[model samples]
Each structure stands twice: as structure tokens, then as C-alpha cells.
Target: MRALFLSEPPFHFGVHEPAPDLPSRIQALVDAGDREEAVVLFQREAVGLPDAMIAQFRATDAFAGVVPLAQSTVYDATLARELSTPTDAMLAVDVPVTILCGQQTFPFLSAAAERLAAAMPHAELIISPESIGHRLDAHAATRILAARLA
Candidate 1:
């Protein structure tokens, strides 16, 4: 079976430094029922997308559809903690695993992809140079996946 994994945090990756206060700050907004502000704060601080891009996205119908789900951002803090957990059992599977990362993504994520590729016997890593931030070029990715499956 063929599988495509995108922007997956490495199992062995660890950030020992204290996390920024953004999570708590966002959580506070969520707790206070200001979910929209929490989402905006996360997009501004954590996602770090350009203001113009964010504005354009916010104008889209898709953004409006998902706005109500912003309250779930509170749970992201818990999910972030679990990202560093070991994944030896999953990596041990013999099926080929393709890990795709954007070349312009954060350094730590690239490092994690490299480390994951090293650990998995049947895994390969691809850094898409044309990708932006954490978003991949889906057309290119589909071609790569097709070749692998062939």
C-alpha cells in the first residue's frame, strides 16, 4: 500500500525550550468564549502567514465555513504535546512510507523529517522546493506518489 504523509512531526523530535505563551493566551480566549479572537491570534502568531494572505483567506467562503470550529484550538495544546511521543512501532511497519515536507517550513520540521527518514527502513523523504511554508504542491506530490506506487 502507498501512503502520503505531510507535515508530520517526528516521533523523536523534542523541543526542550519553554514554549511561547501563545498557547495559554489562545486558550484563555477560548475559555472566555472569544473563539474567533483565539483563531485570529493563532493565525497571526503561530501560523505566521503574511497579513495579506491571511486577509485573502479570511474573505473566502471556506474560511467562513470553518470559523465555528475555531473553539477546537484549545485542544491543539494537548495535541502538540503528543507530537514528540516515540513512533518506533509505526515506523517498523514494512510498507513504504513517503514523508513530504515543504522546503520553506520551519527548520525543526525539516530536521524531524530527516530524522524520521533515517529511522524508517522503508521510508523516504521529499522536500518540495516549490512548496511554501507548510503547504505542499499537491500536483507535484501526486506525481511523486504515483511513481512510487507504480
Candidate 2:
């Protein structure tokens, strides 16, 4: 995944050397920084936004870009439009990719995961029994992901 969804490169190296107050202090800093960075990048990259849309995007950068290894856009027209790929992009990776989608997300991701696993040959799909979310339980998810990737 490298820095696919990270604003900075350091964290990708497993060097997350957070301070004693890192948990408490980092959120505000990362939130603010990620927001500002995403806005600038999107404004530069995304074009033809309605004025209102632009104004709305001005407030946050949460939509900047997805971390490649992270579960992302629901598989749908928007995702297809964003990716413009009828095929699974994960197939191209040298490393195998495992998609663990939230059960609550639009059904397309689960459907797409199956289709992708079929098409990609090297990938795996695991739909969580429970709905997944932004701050999902990392420990449990990690175990699932690790087993699949292994």
C-alpha cells in the first residue's frame, strides 16, 4: 500500500513512533493536516466541480485518496466512474490483495469482491459478518486480513 492513503511516507514504514500524548494529540493534527492536504490536492486534480461543491470541499480533505490496502469506495457506478475499470485493479499487484468489506456497505462491494477474486486469481474476498466502518476493530480485521494475505 506504500503511502497510497497516507499523506506522509513515514507511517508506511511501520515507524509509527507516536509520542506519549500521540493518541490524544495526533488526531487533531492528522485530521487538520489531512483535511488541508486533501483539499489542495483535490482542487488541483478534480475539475468541473459545481461552485457549491467546491465550497463544500473546501472544509475537509477526508475524500482526498484511498489507501490502496484499505477498504474503499463502494463498488458501483461512482466507483466504476472513479476507477473506470471493469476489472479488479488489485490483480495487477505483485502481492495478493484481500478485500474485507463491511456487510452494511452497498452490496456492490461484496458482489464486486467475489467478481474480483474470480477475475484476479491472486486475490481473496472476505465479507465481514458485521458491518464495517471507519474506526473498525483493527485487531480483528487485522487477523482476517493477515490470514488471507498469508
Candidate 3:
């Protein structure tokens, strides 16, 4: 009730748009039964991300659990069409909001955070220097939020 934190939300809010072929290309990989590859492609195309961060993710214990998660995840034209929200809707949010995006995240995502922060009367935008691409720097975010909400 007091505050809100949105970490790398996919909503564009009309700030920017992703490449035209991005969704179809990723979906093609998925339809070919390569959801893992689709995930990688999305990361790469969405933000020009290097493989290092994804390699780190794959090395984690959580990677094994994501196979099913990835299989169930759908990224197609329909989902893409629904990702953006109106700026007026964002402006109508009455609570103080903190929108967090990685400095290395997708251009549209960073732009969305900036746009939301500007539109919302009490919103603050935080670009996490420690994050890579769209992944939040949980430690840094925790520290900042703790201090902020204290």
C-alpha cells in the first residue's frame, strides 16, 4: 500500500518498440521444440545481450527447474500485442512507485521505465548498474528498497 516496485516489467508505454521479426523468430525456435534456444534468442534480440549472463543462469541450480517453465511459456504475436499499457493508465496510479530496470536491459524496457516515472506523479526510476540485460540485481535492489522504505 505504501509503495510499489516493478522490476523490468515488459510494458512499453509507447516509449519504444522491439524489432519487428523478434517475436516470430523466437516463436519459430519454440515451434521447432527448442524452447531453450528460444529463450536465448529472446535475450539476445531483446537487448543485444552477451552470452555471459545466460551462461551464469544456466550454471545455477535453478536452471534445471526452468525446463518445464520454459516449455509452458508462450511468446507470440498475441502476447506481444498485449504487452504495452497506456501512459494515461500509468499516470493514474496513485501510489509511490519505484520502477527498476537494468542499465543493460532492452532499450524499450529502459525507455518504458523512464516514461512511467515521468508519467506517474510519485514514481521513481532506478537503473541498476549491477544488473545485466533484463535481470534485476536482487542484492542491490534489496539494499536500495530497504533504505527507501525505511
Candidate 4:
């Protein structure tokens, strides 16, 4: 069976200009054992999101669930570091891999997807036209995956 990979690793994109201090600030909060505060800070100070969007996310149950896993972001950062060096063994998996990126996402993310697809023999990269920045249109993505799986 084939595997699908969605979203670029955190390190794949350079920091966006609006929130240059985000990573360090979140790290500081985590280091101080304030995981919830870290989550709050992340939502409040995310690089590209406007204030209204952040408020909308804050009101959602999904965001509530995400709050507890805030510390995992640190782990994600670590994983990104590890994945930075994509060795032959890492790319040698024989299964088909689909790497999807948003068309309007940060340029680095699209570039990372291209790099990954080029490195892996069985991987294909798709830039979704229906996507907005890093936010993909879920219905469009679902339909595409369903067609592929079918």
C-alpha cells in the first residue's frame, strides 16, 4: 500500500517576517513549563494569521484540543532537525508517496516538497491549486486522495 504525506516539516519554511520571534518565545514558554501559555502565544502570534482568524481559531473545539499538545511542537522542531538530512535510507522506501503542498504557501515549503519528490524514487509532489497559503481546501484534497486510492 502507498503512503501519503501532507504538510511540510516546520523547518522546511524559513520564519515568516511577521513573527520572527515566535520560535524562541514559544521555546522559552515551554522551557519554563508553561505549555498552555506556549499554545496561547502561538495562536496569538502566528506569523501570517490575522487577528480575526486567530480569534476564530481560539473559539474552536479543535484549537481547544490542540492546546494540550502544545509541547509537541517542540518535539516537531526536533524531528524537523532530524529530517533535515534526508539520507538515501530515508528516501528508499518502496511504497508510493504523495507529497502535497499548498500553492500559495510559503515558497520554501513548495521548494521543500519539490526537493523531497526529486529525492524519492516513488514520491510525487502535488501543489494544490485550491489551497490558500498553508491552508488546504480539505474537500479538494479528500477528493484527490479518494480518486488515487480508488
Candidate 5:
């Protein structure tokens, strides 16, 4: 099995810092018809992606069809609220788990991946240097997963 940024209930990963009001800010940008700025803000603040990665992402078809402001805002808000609840299901998994993360991702994400791998008896953490921000290196992931399966 494989996972990315898995956290048990009450997702406490990062240092003690107040969460930024990202959804509102993004919504405002979108509402103002500054969709490009909204994308930049989302990449920088929410995803912690570097400028180069952000530029590359902006060129993608997925970026062109990013969700509407209202839906995105609601989703982000709900995700924040939901992450606070605790669950023990993750700890019960018995299969070998490969936790993959990008070296350039948010520090908290890397920390969370590390912690999850540490806690899981059959888990391994792989931080791919070729990855950008929260994006995975498809080639590297394919190679690793294939090797594991074999």
C-alpha cells in the first residue's frame, strides 16, 4: 500500500502556528476576477510550492479548470474542520505501507510523512528530490512501487 501525507486523527503535524485564512483570501482573489493571483496565492500559501513549480502548474490543463471559488472555499474550510478529528484506523493497517512525499513540499507534510512511517510497523518513507512542492515524481514513484511489488 502507498500513501501521501497520512496523519492520524487530530492531525497535529506542524509546529505551533496559527493556520492562515487561505480559503477566504483565495475566494476574494477569485471574486475580484484575479484568477491568476488566486492560483499564485493558493500555490504559495496553501501548497507551499516554489515559484518555478507554480509556473509549471499554471500551464497544466488541470489548473485551467480549477474549481469555482465557492466550491473550493467550502472544500478547504471543511477539510480544515475535519482534520481535527481523531481516528485509530490508520494504526490498524497491517500491509506494508510506502509513504511518499516531496522534498520541496510543506515542511509539515514532510514531518507528517516521517512520523507516520515511524509509527507504522511496516511502513517506509521516501522523500523524492525530483518532486516539486506537493507533486510527486511519477517516474520515481513508478520505479519504487514496481520494485516493491516484485
Candidate 6:
């Protein structure tokens, strides 16, 4: 299924580091003429994750592009909506907007989901796997989701 994944950073601060950190990332991306792409709202230092690990991120293809942001939804959506194209709007026409949040993204998940669900025709929260040495649960969730699509 085609999807749009958003993660509220800060919880996984141990996992990612945004290239520009939210506000700047948005500014840079928009300034760089990337308003028509999907941005990665990571939770920590993103540089740490290996390309093999994030190979699933087809932001350059599955998405128009990738965005690494900090923990600010205001900043997040501002860039998201502003740079959005008509086709971008159509992308969510019938596609499921799956928010793969982590266990650490607590109450914020609910609130974020609430906003996202309202904004998109299709959007739901799927608590990602626990962050362990191996992304066992994350992989499990991925397989489970894949099976659902199959």
C-alpha cells in the first residue's frame, strides 16, 4: 500500500539526528525547491542509521524527497502543506496515511494521529516495534503490514 509515515521525534533522539533539525530542515528544503516531496520527521540523529537500515525510505522515489525534522508539528505541517502540490494532495486521495510511531511516542501519538487523520482522508497510528539491538519488532510490524497488503 502506498503510505506516508510520520514520526514525532525526541523519543528516538537516541536513534536519529536531523540534517537540518526541523525548522531549518523545512526552510532549507523549501528554499531548495523540495516542497513537493515527503520529509522524514525523525526522532534523533538520522545520520547514525545506515542506508541498509533505511533502504525502505524511497523518499526520493516513493516520496518526492526526504525531510529530517525535530519535534515540532507546527513546523512540520507548515512545510508539508505549503510545499504540497495538487498531485501531492491526490497522493492521499485513497492511500492510507500510516503513522508508524514508536512506544515512546505516547500521548503525542494520539494527538498527532488526531490531527493527521483529520487532515488526510486516510491516516492511522501504528505503534512501531520496541527499539532494541535488533529492530526485531519493527521488522515484524513491517512484515505484518506487508502481509495485510498482500
Which candidate has the top score in lDDT?
3
Query: lDDT by residue for model 2 over 64-107, one digit each (tens)?
Result: 43322112211221233444333334446546556565554433
Per-residue lDDT of 1-150 in model 1, one digit per residue for the tens? 456454545343564422557678888888888876777776665545457867877888967765677766555544555555446787686788888888787555677788888878888898788676666787878887788778
TM-score of 6: 0.36
Question: Once superposed on the true structure, which residue ranges of model 3 sit more than 4 Å away at CA?
Answer: 15-31, 44-68, 72-80
Residue-by-residue lDDT tens digits, candidate 6, 42-106: 32222233444445544436333234322343364454334322234543567766655555434
Clashes of 1: 0
**Cα RMSD (Å) between model 3 and the true structure?**
4.0
Model 5: weakest 10-residue lDDT segment is 3-12
Query: Could you give candidate 3's per-residue lDDT for residues 120-147 as a string of tens digits?
Result: 7888898889986667887999987997
RMSD of 1: 4.1
Backbone Cα, N, C clashes tallied per candidate:
0, 0, 0, 0, 1, 10
- What's the CA RMSD for each of the models? 4.1, 14.2, 4.0, 4.9, 4.9, 11.6
Cα lDDT of all candidates, in order? Answer: 0.68, 0.39, 0.70, 0.68, 0.63, 0.45
lDDT of candidate 5 over 1-150, digit per residue (tens) = 443333212233444322457677777777887877876776566545679877887888877777344346435544654553224576557787777777777765676677767777777787778776566777977877787777
C-alpha lDDT of residue 36 in model 1: 67
lDDT for residue 14 in candidate 2, whole number 0-100: 13
At residue 85, what lDDT does model 1 achieve? 47
Residue 140 Cα positional deviation in candidate 6, in Å, after optimal superposition = 3.7
10 residues in a row with least lDDT, candidate 6: 8-17
Score residue 47 of candidate 4 by CA lDDT.
32
Backbone clash total for model 5 is 1
lDDT by residue for model 4 (25-93), tens: 778898898876777776555433456866777788877787778877655444554455466776797
